[model samples]
Target chain A: MTAHTSSSSSLGLISSATAISQGAEAKVYYASLHPAPSPASTTETVDVLIKHRFHKGYRHPSLDNSLTKSRVAGEARALIRCLRCGVHVPGIRMVDAAEGVLALEWIDGKSVRFLLGGGAEGEEEEAADSEDSDVAEAAAQEDDTDPLSEYGATQDELMAMVGAEIAKMHRGDVVHGDLTTSNMMLRHPRSEKGLQLVLIDFGLAYTSTLVEDKAVDLYVLERAFASTHPASEPLFASVLRAYQAGMGREWTAISKRLDDVRLRGRKRSMVG
Target chain B: METYHYPSFPADASHVHIALFKNVSNAAELRSRIVRASLLEGSEGDLEREAVNFAFIDARLICSRVHLQTAIYQAVLAHAQGALRTKTVHSEILWTLNPSNNISEAIRRYGVSDTTAFLIVVRISTANDANVLANMQAVVSGELSRFSLEGITDWASVKKYYKLNSEPALKIQGITLVQERKIIDEIVTSTVAMKSVMT
Candidate 1:
């Protein structure tokens, strides 16, 4: 804790930010870049999400610093690659590699997991629901109407967006190592193209053009769906169908590889 | 003209003033002066350097306001951390804008050229000096206008410089002009912001 406390000066700008979540690697915060304007003022200021990777008390300070720096650099690089490839990910706003802080465009919306009814069952979600009226509205609104329709998309349509976006990213040779429903988001109603799905959290993302890697990427998401959603087999099937269409000629090889992956699991045999 | 104050930056290096100059007739002279300022020595050199302290960017190569802002932000970050690859923060902005690492190549491509018709002049200073704008106007013989990024971009050069013609993102079908420009701007801005980490 002292290791992290000493480095808090590096995150001085984010001192005023609202702490959003705490993962093992980084602490996420929601903040506005500029001072909040007066209520009547029309000045446009976008909010940002700051991901601060604090020091670990257990690791050697020198080793921790290098690892933190590289990870920050790697995540920023992957996000930039996705942006250039036209994948809908958060645009980077600012970076301080030494401080291990990466500030990104704040996405305003609910995670796909929350939209799909999986989030309501969690204790974390219950606490989050009580704290944020907006999240509560999203959850309550979904229960009252067609759950997926609030985003202007059916369940099938939302699955297709997830598939198409991932395919676009794979086409750019960037593999998202972690692909769960929670990592995907639908933009809020006020934004342009409100229904558009955005992929987030590139901390584990890397550049890999291998068909094996791409298949494994999809398989991770497929397993996540199975574990989290009821009657998810058909939902995962629909995602694959859209992904096949988006990949075009490249789909055949990846689809075949995905079948092989399902049979043998994610890892290749080491005995051979 | 627009003045941006970055709250996160140190007090001495927070304010940034940007101005767009169009219909410039002395680009060749300004370019030569910048080159000459680098070689001067002692007190005489200090006076010359102060006269042209701002970053004179080729406005045609800029895709949008965010694109320039991203470069400025990254350059300022590098300056603050003492990790600048170039001598000054102003020149570092030009280095970040270019795709490659060659310093001279970056300057040649993004800096004011003999044929540059429009320019974006930026001054990063401690105080919001009232005379900064006046000084910029006095140096460049051109008509100063509001720093609006619309209608001033040269997309063809941007494509050529970034080598976007071969990129799959830009080659996709049925992408509208507006959509294409938006993609380009986002990519360029992201590239500038992440240049330090770029492999």
Candidate 2:
């Protein structure tokens, strides 16, 4: 058998071990390097994030192949650009465009939407009631709540991160075509660095400097916040405020465009 | 010479053999020679192919013995099971470097790149446990000269093949040549280790 045979068969080994996380374009799985003896043997295992671009039955083979390759390459390029801009995105570990897979650093945390009374853990609400808000707050203050509680970020903080990250991305001329709380995650707070909001799912991302595109991007997030999380008006306002800080003079143009976008919806009147 | 054993492999599937060449010139010569030797008369062909059965990686791409060993082990598994995704055994070495299934592209980009000088051939076949270590030692201690990096390496060809000119990794400001080399090594190493994560 040729190398190709072995590789295809080995797919069973790779995909099986990864913990699958679903999204629109692909399924993500956690990758790990295990049992290797290291100087720091305790740190033998390194967590990785794998994005598998599954075969799309609807699309034609030729179109699908190019689309898949482009998306994979696009995401990797966007990530590299983000890293250079000092944006706290996951580091790229592997890129197999032909197979439509990308491996990234596995961030240990939960989605920000989950922490902000969103649709992450429905059972947690019932449990939260049992613990009581005051007790939870006390525990939170003492840093003695559930180990994952740190991943449960507030709506306001998450919004700030959203605003800041978008501003940074726009400054670098990269448009995150899709922005939603569910696509954003909060890393576990272990250092003084505090909460880190990570942007995920860049399938639709592209390079563009259009103010209109940037405004629409923010609008997508705004709609997501309102629809998914409860009582998010003030939270979004805080987000915009941080965004205004980061955007500098460009804020006026985008803010105006964003207001227009909110009224007219995402599709701008193309009829000239 | 260093030898490693993977305990998971079946017992009968183990056997060992080694061949040491004196002053093997360059990658091209070595490759053609291996091919020519493999096409020889029946028993001779078997013997020659067995001797050159392992991958002959450019030692410059290697970081340390541990790193090299990890790659070799993975390659052996792929070879024994006929699991290679690429077209050829030579190209499979490049695929082993990349964290993906794009075997041809990996070969086009990495295998036999210009800067390659010191080549290390690795062949895996059924080997008796007792003789494997001794054979490995003989191969390593053979008549080959310890290659010096200064006089070798085709930089222009390497740059052309990998398209390293426009890579952002190479464009980072304030990085020294040494730093660039270290970064390149790391990129290659990480790429090799990430194959499992790739498709």
Candidate 3:
């Protein structure tokens, strides 16, 4: 009744899951948390997003194992920190470090990038995780309505949600190292915690209290906006306003630091 | 009782049979027998272990079916890797559910207690292995019940065990109690999944 090899169980979950997208560091898959409940019973299993930092042939086996294990653990830590801090991040569903698999609550929503018209030219159209979006997307296109409207948020409010969510994470002292539009999503309007902005991807996130770290986080996101969206100033201003409102008294110093960051670029002037 | 089949696991350990028993009457005797089974020796030990091999869980502590399944999946994953924290995958499931590294604490808190009226018996083995439902019924005197987590979760115990009382996630203004429970379930489920990696 035993004597099974290591790592295959999680790989089994992955094999059952449909591969959605692949990145240089990890591959993402969509799957149910349990085997679909028997057809006789109408109970639906929860869906989970599986992120696997697959094995690399170039690195030694032990080193690869340790690296994969640590990275997966680090990402899980960041996500848990966000969840505890009341940030709108997907809850972690599972973590199997030995297999480099991290499972997250599957978000049924559209990425902010697509809602903002920035997804068309992007490399990773991670905007829509919804498999049933084809019909809704087609209808939205037919009406020529802004996709953001369907989520019940105006562009201004979406930006505000984005800013506030980031502020909450910063308030918790967790910095998202990457803050692209694609990394943030608007939960489907009808789901639990409807139409909220949820942040995803903590692969590079870290804990920090330094105002400089927070400012740099804003700066990186600002740059992402400039490069990805046309006429980005107003959009970024909306984000910062909500961010400033959320940050309250802590906003002033970070704002000044952000301005300084903008002048010198993301990299600070280094001295040996 | 419904069986979940995992296509990826080895044939011997591919399926998990779960039976929820309500109004369990012999939990006290069942608990003592389980203890005795652990201490018995030789062929007698083998027979006793086989008789009560299922992981007997207190249904009140489980927030959602996802919470239970996550533990089972992690246990299977550990068993497959030969890195089980306990002697068997069944115990590993209990350990994962307990939220602490102490094995005894896990079993004592999550295992079937004398007062456990709602019991969940789980067995992971080949799908062809018969008598799973019969065995579960034989070990515990209770009525077979539909599998649903509604109305049974003891929220106070769950929140206290997870230490979610003052956490900011629940402290958010305007959040309903239902919303808070959803958050708790999510946090607890994630904790179970990440037990091995938690610092």
Candidate 4:
């Protein structure tokens, strides 16, 4: 009953928010905590990203509710663990787990995928607008001069940040079940820590102390890079190098396991 | 004093009033009064309760304005949905700040103590009554200052309460004290935000 009330309230909030993306399991929205400020005021409104895991029609009603609740809780927990480990993940702003709504701090820069020229198909049109006229107009209207340059990081530097952040998460025994360029973001140059890489989308993440799990995490990212980016081998190698440096002595075992994982895929054989 | 409106909540419960009180010399008296008010009955008790209706948080434990705001927001959310774990939204704010689920422990650590010097008081209401600020000032015997967060945080106590000394986020190399505190503040505020769902 409480879950029902909370879920309906969360749905109401989402209904009012501007939908940013719609996926199979959840929908993302751009939202704000504070009301819109006056036109003349220079104060900044707090922006948030709301991730709502809506009800699944395929599953039974009760089963779907429980699954959504648990998944939302799990994701929030993994993110908190990552933050404690110094991993660059979006900070949570609000969570209604029973309602399957999680609000997070809105990172104000482009995704690594977009910056690396592997933007999603839907974003291609917006990404291609490199004309100086519109850019100048936008620059005059807003603070950001150019969205792409806001990160101020080279491709190699971005990769290194990605690898180092992942290593930190793995060292804390958290496995990001999904890791891809699309899930990593580079902070705007004007942010507190300019040009920092932030990992996002912990909906599939979980905690595991096993070396196998850690290796598999890295392998997933490697595969993602190889598929998404052109000439990704050297880029991934640099990522591993930074990861190795971050992990130090712990890297040796995970590196060997990763090599084996790369050969055998994500699944471990159970035939033995 | 600052006010926030939550569009998702009912109008009666949407308005939030927050004020910071520094140099609080009557903390011990306020604590005792609150305890006494809890045991009162009928109109007399109602009057006593009205006097100390705000969440009197120990400001020293708060990392930043955002940290306090996060707890207040979550508490208000729980209240709006009829899912409050504690008796009232004011107490719930304190409950959400503690890492553990123990209600009394949360109050003991985050609630105003006899030795409390700095305090952050918050009230969640439906109406933006003109008397709210005056009422708060009447109850608290401390100086009301601008709600600026700088220089008000007790980082040492915060790290102790959150157990951040062993956290890897603080152990990273090349992180200055200011940067480390920023990370800690973000993490702590985030933890409070999601405390309701934390298992």
Per DockQ, the best of the predicted structures is 3
- The regions of model 1 sitting more than 4 angstroms off are A1-10, A34-42, A120-143, B128-130
lDDT of 3 by residue, A1-272 (tens): 11332437777778778988888899999998677654345466678899999888888888998999999988988888888778989888878898898999999998888889775323334336655555655665688878887777899999999999999999999999999988999999898667789999999999999999999999999999998899999999999999999999999999999999989988888888
Candidate 3: tens digits of C-alpha lDDT, residues B1-199: 9788888777778898888899999999999999999999999999999999999999999998888988998898888777899999999999999877999999999999989999999999987888888888879899888898789999999989888888887888898889888888888988888887888
The ten-residue window of minimal lDDT in model 2 chain B covers B12-21
lDDT of 1 by residue, B114-162 (tens): 9998999999888657798789988899988867667889998898888
Model 4 stretches astray by more than 4 angstroms? A1-8, A36-44, A121-150
As for TM-score, the candidate ahead, 2 or 3, is 3
> With candidate 1 superimposed using the best TM-score fit, by how many Å does residue B119's alpha carbon deviate from the native?
1.5
Q: Count clashing pairs, candidate 4.
A: 1
What lDDT is reached at residue A60 by model 4? 88
The residue-by-residue lDDT of candidate 4 on B93-176, one tens digit each, is 999999999999999999999998888888888765668889888878999977766787889888888889999889877888
lDDT of 1 at A119: 65
lDDT per residue for candidate 2 within A1-272, as digits (tens), equals: 12442345224435455656565578777756332331222333445677888768788877887888778878877766665454556656555565676767677777767667553534345556766754755555586444334556555666778788777778777888878877777777762234677777777888888999999999998998898877879988998998899889999999999999999999988888
Residues forming the 10-long window of minimal summed lDDT in candidate 3 chain B: B4-13
Candidates, ranked, lDDT: 3, 4, 1, 2
Model 2 chain A: ten consecutive residues of lowest lDDT: A33-42
